[model samples]
Target: MKKKQWQGWGPGEQAEQHYLVEPRALAGGGDIRHVSEFLRACGWRDRSKPGGPLLMDSLDRSIRIAYDPFVHPGGWTIHGKATAHQEEWTAILGRQAPVEIVAGLTDALTRPRSAHAPNVWAPLQEQRWHTPPGAGHVTAVSPDGLAWMQFHQDPGGHAMWWSGAQDQQGNGWTAQFTATTPMHLVQSYAAALASPEPVMRPRGRVPHSARIRTTSVSVLPSQLSAWKQARVTAARAATSARNSWKTNRPRTTAHPHAQRGVRAHR
Candidate 1:
């Protein structure tokens, strides 16, 4: 069957064209969770386990690599004939851009545009410098203007963020994007060209937890005793409070002269 134009998990025209149980696909469809399950059910393939439809993400990463050409940011071609792009970036999302590249790309992407003529001035933006989506370009150049960088933001919905750069010698390398995406991507491209292990290059704040050795954690005997004492004290205080409340409660006595139904003065 002809795949849907988009790469994401959706039935599209595939439902009507291929094997799909309409009622099951539509069951609990109002909620997104059930809807996706229903769509997966429509494309159920494992005949041995007919009831269990494999999840989209659970599909091997190789599938995405195969579909890389049709993937987003539309301009993967600019990075040359590399298929590792999607697989690599998806693995490295939270990782950071290198330190050195960050400074240069900062100057590039955030460089003030000349109000006189933005066209005359390069179109510099703070984050992923805009391209005609999926297209890559010379997003930034070095301070000395000796080197330049390129980046491609996936035109598709996936945030598989990586970009490439080439130096004066025409050597190129790849780098990942962090949450600090656009500027850093611009920076990482330049840095990647210079550094041999660009992807593994360390940058950004070291997490505090990384400094500590993790051993089995347990409450000390003294701590446990203190906790027990505290609980006992709390229980005693609650009982004391309850008793005090009952003792302090106001009491009423009826007088012979008072109306039968009226509450007697306390």
Candidate 2:
């Protein structure tokens, strides 16, 4: 059987330029939408057959959902050391992993050889939740790797909430309180809203100093230490990996028929 490849781009695009490395499960790939193809990779769909019902009742079996998820007050650029994953029940489904696996995964996540330990999870206000300044139903696989969830909102209601959590290694999960609705109205409205935006000309040039200003953000010393430690661990791991590769490389011996130098020895 052919190996499945998880890709954000198709035949014409490159992943580096397009993808923001995802968090926590450790594979590097971009977010998936129109996941019919992704479903194929996961063996959720039969590749030889056409796609089937993508209905809500069909999804809830695996997702364990909740309605009216809470929205964060504002955009939060929170940076800190990677925090431990709590085995607490989810607000939506009250979902919790088994103690042993959860603990094992937690330790592995916080183990010695990791870096990039920031976790970002702030939901923008509803007005800006699903457009350019907002995120659409941010998609992710379930913790059990069984189903996909779209943490998005609808026109008449806030359909779902999605929050992303990641470890220092860019291993991440986008947890969601998802719901499905008849999206025809939303689709139509979006189509109408897709018209060209009005062009606005600036009245005059503002003074340079007023227009731009230098700013500094204060970070906790603990956060700084954590960030630095993560980097150090990553660097050491890279060096060790290089050494191992050199040690294990196949030896290149002299050719059997190669010419030999004639020298006299005392």
Candidate 3:
């Protein structure tokens, strides 16, 4: 079967440009709007005023989302408190993490799930992420065998999974997701990471961090044009949807972040 790929881009160092297909999960790409707009579409209310932190919540108030650039590694912080109907969960995406990858987690939050819906380790296992016999952790080694990802089943203190990688030059990065985050979301993330899709990046900025595993290729003019068109189409659709939503929803406190055109990874 053909593999699904995640799309993303990164900066480069070379004057003569080329495309590097890397996993956005590790390289980090996409804009903040990818998250914010999707939330709005799912009936999340924006509660931030002008010049304040971006804050939003689900209609039922079980999930809360915050984006404060002032915070270290500022990206999107999501919290789900146990309510009469749901269990507690927490997820954090660093400022540089891929919005698409994070979307998998967010999208999972909007739906109903059972405890036995799916195993988080399934996708990773398909991609060769493994747990040693009698071991409590699962791991996937990169193609080059120098980088890896790991998940701890009983990591304690809410911490469930985390991964890190570094290049020979010593640059590196690490990411973690908390327990109770929903296995479906974790499965979505793992599936994307294990996907064969080539995340596009500039040759100069090929390795955004040490953990990225990619092969460099010269971008065809056709690919660039296609990418541009897809972006334009998506932007127009989002704008139209947002406009329709604003017209129908009851008025709430004004929020400027919901209206800003700022791109996430510009």
Candidate 4:
């Protein structure tokens, strides 16, 4: 009898995946007691189990208790079994409460941005008691999800925020904070550098010294070349000395014989 070769079908022909059966939705102000009943009816565990009812009950209660709107504004909640002993509820809840509260606070603080507009600027009209008088408005910048730079006021009085790529050669940017003359100049420079349009250039070559001015003298090319050559020569000499030492190393026998000859002559 000849053996058969099986050619397996590709992924598209594979059996569809399935998930664990989800708990049926509860109705009419379901609470912890209801959740425990449902789980028991579903044959999750027997009533005699240490955590069978109490554990499920507590989790259900936690889910039902209204989370601080400031923290869980989305109204999302979760319910699940915990592995710790039934008596461990006190410790678990104590530890979990602070963490949950912190998470809620963080969510509340950050939620406004996503729910709001692309760019929003809040100008400070007056300095508060804590802040100095006329201490001007500060601007913040954010890109993607989080803010990078916080309220920083530039030399100008006007306040605004900016975001995006870092400034690099041929891709520079500037921001303005005030409308004062100096600020205007800064804005001009920023606009000039940030414009997407290519910058116009003179066809002729400009002298290097004209581009940048410095009071200190710079080394001439000839001098720099001479210095480099001198360094190379010194390094070569040092290497030769090391090689010669290795080649001319005295043998132990030769040293002993020379010492004996010197003692005999004496």
Candidate 5:
């Protein structure tokens, strides 16, 4: 069977350039013997026609076999640490490994290794979120991996929003929202509204229900931290109050005289 191969390119390269391999040929390649042994241990079979030596068609094909040059000497050090932790959990739980075990394993495997860990799987810390000035909300949508669309809420409050999606075509369209009117009427009115010179008066007047304006503000890191701390303090106070209320309820209900006094106040 043909093996899958991945190609990588570095700076100043016009085209992608790399090599290929297949598992059977690694037995003769000195450094690749370790990989061949690992595969054999994993019970991989050739599964070709019986009574013939497994023949890898080409050197290119033979070299396409499993090899991860990116792995460090510690052998995915973060993964090793995580697996060790998981073994501890398995030992403690002892034969009650639920579906959560699989989920925990996946989390361990996928979590970021370190602040400056080399990213072999995907781009590192590239995704970002930012709200535009005077906009109520901003969201990013990516259809292809390369490009993204930023949708912004219209601050003018015409009950409309705007977004621009770029394609291969150079010229893109700008869409604006106008009051719902017949297309012909809208066109004729729009034409009339258009200035013959620089300054022109309105041909017909249209009434709007209300005018809307948005205020934009910038928040500092200290302000944001303060706000978060305030919220946490408020939440803790609320929880304490709730617990106090719960504790007091038994005493209030148990004592007839206290209940009577409370009822009289109500």
Candidate 6:
């Protein structure tokens, strides 16, 4: 099959191509604003200092988010501490990873939930990724052999899952999460990685690592711009709605009788 040329984003900084149904190979961290807005809505307070990494902490201080572009491997990190009755875990959605894909993990991490373990490999399996027989480590690789995901069971250390994608030129990126990371969060990542939706990128801006394997179709700049704008609009709308509710919500007052404690119930 004849593949289209990767039209680097043009001189106007417009999108040059759209990779259909792939995100792991997409260059750069995705729309991080979505992540920041989402965390803020979840009551995560931004503690980032000027010109530093975007650092945020949960209300109860059990979770933290760190997004640093300047540092390698520091990328987007979600750390969950073991409370008095809980265990600690960490997930790193690498710097080169797409923002939209990584946000799935963050969304799952922040949402309240009960404990449950879904088969994390189910998504990959359903997507037709293959696992080698008799492999010591659990792993699955895309049919094209360009992408692979795996989980390592380490008894003496943190059991972890990591996934990556690359081109023929040996350029690629990976994401990692510990076994203690919630199954749902892991599943969310698995699902996103297995998704068939194509990711849009400026043809010119494609990272060196993805160049060889990246075959993209040139798309209208507006197509990419509109997509980006839609996402921002949605996030802003959600924030506005939340703020409006907070502002317009009726406040409840304590009953005077209740305040009196009903004679101490003696």
Best by TM-score: 6
lDDT winner, 2 or 3: 3
Using TM-score as the yardstick, the better of models 3 and 6 is 6
Query: What is candidate 4's lDDT per residue for 153-230, written digit by digit as tens?
Result: 567644343322221222211222222212222222223222222211111211122111222223333443465466
Ranked candidates (lDDT, high to low): 6, 3, 1, 2, 4, 5
Off by over 4 Å in 5: 1-212, 250-266
Which predicted model would earn the best lDDT?
6
Encode model 1's per-residue lDDT on 2-57: one tens digit a residue: 44343332343232111111111011111122212222332322222233322232
lDDT tens string, model 5, 1-266? 44333244333433222122111111111222222322233233333334432211111122112222233311100111123222211111111111121122222221224445432112111333233355445433222211222333456853322222223432122222122211222222122112121111111211111221122233333444465466445544654675678677754335888779889999
lDDT of 3 by residue, 180-199 (tens): 66667777766665565666
Error of 6 at 113 (Å): 3.4
lDDT of each: 0.30, 0.28, 0.63, 0.27, 0.26, 0.72
Which candidate order results from sorting by TM-score in descending order? 6, 3, 1, 2, 5, 4
TM-score of 2: 0.18
TM-score of 4: 0.16
Q: What TM-score against the true fold does each predicted structure earn?
A: 0.19, 0.18, 0.61, 0.16, 0.17, 0.70
Q: Which of the predicted structures, 5 or 6, would earn the higher lDDT when compared with the native?
A: 6
Candidate 3 all-Cα RMSD:
13.7
Residue 185 accuracy (lDDT) in model 5: 23
Poorest 10 consecutive residues of model 6 by lDDT?
14-23
* Candidate 1 to truth, TM: 0.19
Candidate 6 local lDDT, 138-227, one digit each (tens): 999877677778988877875788887777875567888887787878888887777756655555655665443455566766666676
CA lDDT, candidate 6, residue 137: 89
Residue pairs with clashing backbones, model 3:
5-197, 12-204, 12-205, 13-204, 13-205, 14-204, 31-264, 32-264
